[model samples]
Target: MAEIETLQELYVDELKDLWSANDQMAKALKKILGQATNGKLKDMLQASQDGIAKHTDVLKALIEGQDEKLKKEHCKGMEGLVAEALKHTVEEAPKTGPVLDAAIIAQYQRMTHYGITGFGTVAAFAKALKLDDDATKLEAAVADMHKGDDLMSELAESAVNVEAVKG
Candidate 1:
């Protein structure tokens, strides 16, 4: 028979997985920013980098608060996503304006979706464990990032650079 998993076990495992994912995304985004030629794209990357740092801090506190040691399990999901983003970036490099912008938007959205999923999962786990304060804080942070992701999508769809790519 399969062993049943406790809530604490689930939370700790998921948190470690998420932390690793965030670190991977952070590195990938920084690399993209370094290669980005568009001022607006660079700004977005910088904002995202800051957000990733904040998320890392929160994850660390949550793990430590549970008396768990800070550690990361390899997050294969995030590794795959980051690899794909790097491939796309390399495939479209130096193709500035709309083409480059479209690629950036696509890659950014993928990373954002990954973050949203991770944060939401953590928040739900916190709630299930009756960790009310932690749940609230995690949910708030997730909500803010969700909004940012939506805004980035909107900007990509309507921005001149994206439009230029389609022209």
Candidate 2:
């Protein structure tokens, strides 16, 4: 990673990091998605994988627009999150039922929240740098992530968590 002396440099670096993070997350989701017991949760996880791919495209375009190399710096922050997610969902996973479903949602949301923060910050950076189009696209990505998070919360509250406790 180059030394980020200006906000523009920082923004570009962040976009690269997010690209790597998205790839890591998408791979992990495939593993986690199969572990999901609830049908709705499984569906959501599938959709999230699709969303991550779309967001990666956006990151690629944004990087190209900035004349940066189409390369991703490994995001250690998301590496840690992914490690924890795998540890919880795969290694120390609960029984393959509502209990595991609940745990999956918790880990997914933690990573999603990280995405929300990263995209939101990048959107702000784009705005500060007078990149209106980039800001709009990034904000849209943030909105998509938030919607996914909300749906997860709803599923957890309405079904998964409830079923978890009934066991």
Candidate 3:
């Protein structure tokens, strides 16, 4: 039989998973930014790296404020997503500009979607546990990041690289 976990325990576990995921994302974005040839893509990757660092600090503070230990559980979901992104980035880099941009867009969207879902779920969990302030702050940050991701998608769709691919 599966053992049931208390709300506090579940919250901690989720936070740990999120922390590990963010760390992995930060590392991946740094690598991608270093290898990226497109100026815009490199800039976006750098911005994401900064955002991930800020998010990690926020999560750490939340955990410590609750008197909880900061420990990370492996986030397999993020690992898989990152592995796929790395594969695509390498495979598509040698292609034409539009195709490369398309691949980058697809990879970035996947990561953003993962972040949106993770943060939303964590916020709900915090709310259920009566961590009201944490929930509000985390939700706001997540929402802003989601908005940024949407704007990036729009930019990618209208970019000259995308148009070149279609030409």
Candidate 4:
């Protein structure tokens, strides 16, 4: 981690954290996708992974622009989220079927919500620093996260939760 003194430094730190979070989520989603029994859920997770990769690239560029090495500051919050997700979706979740799908969805949303907050804060930090371009890029990331959340809600209501209850 670089020495962070000003709000701009804080912004870069947050950006680094988000970079780590994106990487962690991308890896977690792959494991979760394998565990998921629902085809729609699998597709959604795949799409999210693609988005995460793109976002990671953006974060890397920003970090490098700060005269710092392109590296991630371990996001402890994301680490915990990933651990909890593995517990639910891999270790203790049902072996298969709608019940497991429900668990995956639940865990996935937890991660997505985390991204939403992190990205939103980064965008706000960029705006506060009067970096409009960075802010716009970050806000776009936030929008993508919200879209994922919305899809999860739709899947839960229309299929996943209903099927899960029948278990």
- Per-residue CA lDDT of model 1 for 11-113, tens digit only, reads 8788888889989999998787766655777787899888888988888888899998888878999999999888887655646556666677788889889
User: What lDDT would candidate 4 get against the real structure?
Assistant: 0.89
CA lDDT of each prediction against the hidden true structure: 0.81, 0.96, 0.78, 0.89
Instruction: Answer with 1 or 4, whichever has the higher lDDT.
Output: 4
State every prediction's TM-score relative to the real structure: 0.90, 0.99, 0.89, 0.95
Residue-level error in angstroms, candidate 3, position 139? 0.5
lDDT of 4 by residue, 110-130 (tens): 999999998899889989988
- By summed lDDT, the worst window of 10 consecutive residues in model 2 runs over 87-96
RMSD of model 2 against the true structure: 0.6
TM-score of 2: 0.99
Q: What clash count goes with each model? A: 1, 0, 0, 0
How does residue 143 of candidate 4 score in lDDT?
A: 91
The top-ranked prediction according to lDDT is 2
**Model 1, which residues run further than 4 Å from truth?**
1-4, 91-96, 160-162
Rank candidates by TM-score, best first: 2, 4, 1, 3
**Model 4 misplacement above 4 A:** none
Question: Residues 51-152, candidate 2, lDDT per residue (tens digit)?
Answer: 999999999999999998999989999999999999999999997599999999999999999999999999999999999999999999999999999999
Candidate 3: tens digits of C-alpha lDDT, residues 1-167: 12437877777777778898999887777666655656676777778778888888888888887787777878899999989887887644646666665677677779878988988898998999889999997898797688769777876777835665774
Q: Judged by lDDT against the true structure, how good is candidate 1?
A: 0.81
Extract clashing residue pairs from model 2: none
